[model samples]
Target chain A: MHETALTQNLINIACRALEGKGVTKVNSVTLCVGALSGVLYDAMEFAFDAMKQGTVLETADLDFEELPVTARCRDCAYEYNPVGFPYICPVCGGRYFEIIGGEEVYIKNIDCIGDDDVVTD
Target chain B: MSQIKVNTDLKALNNEIAAQNKEKLHSCGILTVDVLGSPGSGKTTLLENILPELAAKCRVAVIEGDLATENDARRIEKTGVKAVQINTNGGCHLDAKMIERQFEKIDLENTDVLVIENVGNLVCPVSFALGEDLRIVVLSTAEGEDKPLKYPTAMLKTDAVVVSKTDIAEYVCVSTDKLIGNIGTVNPDVKIFTAGKTDGEYRAEGLVEYILEARKNLK
Candidate 1:
């Protein structure tokens, strides 16, 4: 829903990261999106495509790596990927568990071309 | 051609501001609660019932977030407590920056509890931390029993779940027990409360008491 705002932030962060590097163009931006992050992939891509115009990332391709939900049972100390709703520990049927992964939206890295990489016309 | 490593959480800036908001509110001895739910999930109605009771115990202020309209803030003000309205202008959630901007308008030192009614959304608001001490998700019986499971991320991030409008559960063919049970399935540790009219009186004493207790525990 707030993908537009988030995409703007993504651009700001990338721009800041490349400020002093003499980068000529951004090639791609990689993001790690979790299953439970509540970020709709299609919406994010749409927002990126629209908002990236005129920014430093105008030509950058947005790449996403999806991570599955993982949890650890507090009772039996069992760790496993949760497959369905009402996530229960497979080993002990314990409902009490701590989510250990798949709730984050992280900017992994960016591929860019430095000024040195551009051939003279 | 180079790949620069920039491993950063998208919400890092918001979280940083949230931590600052927490410290500032805590320093003034105020307990903050962020209320989240879908539109028409009875979030405002629940607050209308509980705010009077909460105000009697301590100074209470409310920050109401809506995509548009001052209606919610007006409703809150009718309880005789201060209410600040934040119109998101179509934004889906309230971020830490928005909450921080309201601090100057509110009498922080004199307030004991600040209830922030977030823009009615079960998705986007769950990701943005607003520096509140407690995050409460309000779910109505009319929304059905599968809401918690369908929106597990919202349930998981919340500290409490309030099943509102329970008075009409039977009329809606929804069981409050099943709803509460489903909530526990997704978030076993979350404190649950129910609010509705029973025998011609609004009931949410458990929720009121819970908030009071949370305020008392804030050191």
Candidate 2:
């Protein structure tokens, strides 16, 4: 029940999509998460399992697309992806940079079952 | 059968809360700074010493996150400023939702500086974001010089590193030089400071000055 709120939100969104599309059950839910998003995948999964127990997504699968942290240099305007922490500009060696990409955590898509067949929504 | 359709990202709710908190902080031009460190690393002591110095110049608000006890909050309140203690119960790190809730209780407009003291753990706290202007990690000499290398994540994400307990550096075999070198290896640009006891009082002028200078740089 710790992630009840989060789980409720997830189920609400997923259930709506399922019913709207005339799908009887939701097979899985997919998400795209950036490395810098600061989300605990394990915790989210645990919360999902606990939260979806009695809902329409009781047995839905959760998929994740992990993205890396990418930034652009302020000095040279060079763009690059940072592998680990202590981000620096790859081109100009400038410490100052803007995070132009990564840090994305969103619902990329979902999968559902319509009538008696599997479908992607 | 009528079908009901809804397309929503569940995480959006949390993100919305985070955005509101960000806007509130932005309107006031106040920067939220997070202080992270391991247990027994002299984090509270460093803050206690610097609070009065910083508070004298600007209105500072503190959000202290701990597994238990409001003791740190009490200590910070003695500085004659606003302090809120967030008890995480058993959570290892302080998440944005918790901070978003805390932001509601503080008047961000009057606050010039906001300091969030993260739960005492180098590993977990590094992975969690609390929307801070700068993330400073505190390491004490007693914790050994290899701490930065051992807990590379904390050092890697930090904008600065504070080496505390320099007052007893000679008594302990902690290689301050080696520690600085290792820290530079992981994060070359991270501002480093050493706070130790000098003469009759603890001298942390460098660290204090860094904070003051940082506040001026904030937009």
Candidate 3:
């Protein structure tokens, strides 16, 4: 899986967050990437290997929550998931449907030892 | 015996940076214009005509992103504005971090407009957001009418579209109506600007007018 720059960007951002809060060893990593966000999960993991090398986020477990494309029809207010590309409402077949969600790319939380841990030389 | 729950996703960090970049641009009262298109789309010609005029009215600057070379930046600087060349060195797109770093190198406090000439690719540039207020997609008449429909991502993300090389539209067999129709299918509201660099009867003038209008709207 060749990581796109987008995934690498996410990894770089995560690394900064980890370092900022003094997260030496991350217990788990969870992300919510929307279908429309155009983020590839496999590529993200591929980038994590090289991007996190020699960093505090070296061995963090990367978890991803894939978001589906949900749309609300403008004509009939019908909400539904996209069956395929060229997203259109199934019930009303509305050409224009506002994107309600599934573009989220953020961390919910992290388990890390706050600086009050064992002494380090 | 204890249990810990750590849910850290690094992607949020980039998103935060993107937000911060947007906030900075917003506070400056400047509109970050992202110019995206395929190779040889006459993006340079459009800028060459518009930048000097825009700079005369308001403080303007450019952040040029490309696979390599300062060619586009060099071209824009001739119009008498600070053009910072960001050579991506084969990268397909420009991300928020790249734009954020460019901000440090240039001053946008008094600047009224920030034009980002993104790498010439119709696909990848749409995937990355550089915190721009508006994304402009340029297509030359020489590129054909089916361009927008084939590269839907670029059209979908664009706030405006410019059909360049309009003077050569007849020779190239590029139908203006068909091109507009394709763009309309994807983005019905996007303003379309027809432009070129022919001496007297050029459409470049109208394009500059649109840029001015965009500036006023951003303000």
Q: Which candidate is the best by DockQ?
A: 1
lDDT accuracy of residue B62 in candidate 1: 97
Best by TM-score: 1
All candidates: interface RMSD: 5.5, 6.8, 7.5
lDDT of 3 at B170: 82
Ten-residue segment with the worst summed lDDT in candidate 3 chain A?
Answer: A112-121
Ranking by TM-score: 1, 2, 3
Give the per-residue Cα lDDT of candidate 1 at B199: 97
TM-score of 2: 0.75
The better-scoring model by TM-score among 2 and 3 is 2
Model 1 achieves a DockQ score of: 0.52
Task: Please provide, for model 2 over B93-199, each residue's C-alpha lDDT reduced to its tens digit, 9 standing for 90 to 100.
Answer: 78778998887789887998899998898776775567777888989888887777677657767889998888787689877888888788666767998877889
Badly placed stretches (over 4 Å) of model 3 are A9-35, A38-68, A74-77, A81-95, A101-121, B1-11, B170-173, B197-201
- Candidate 3's docking class is incorrect
DockQ of each: 0.52, 0.27, 0.22
Tens-digit lDDT track of model 2 for A18-111: 6646566666777666665556688788888887887778867887778776777778999899765456777777876666766555666666
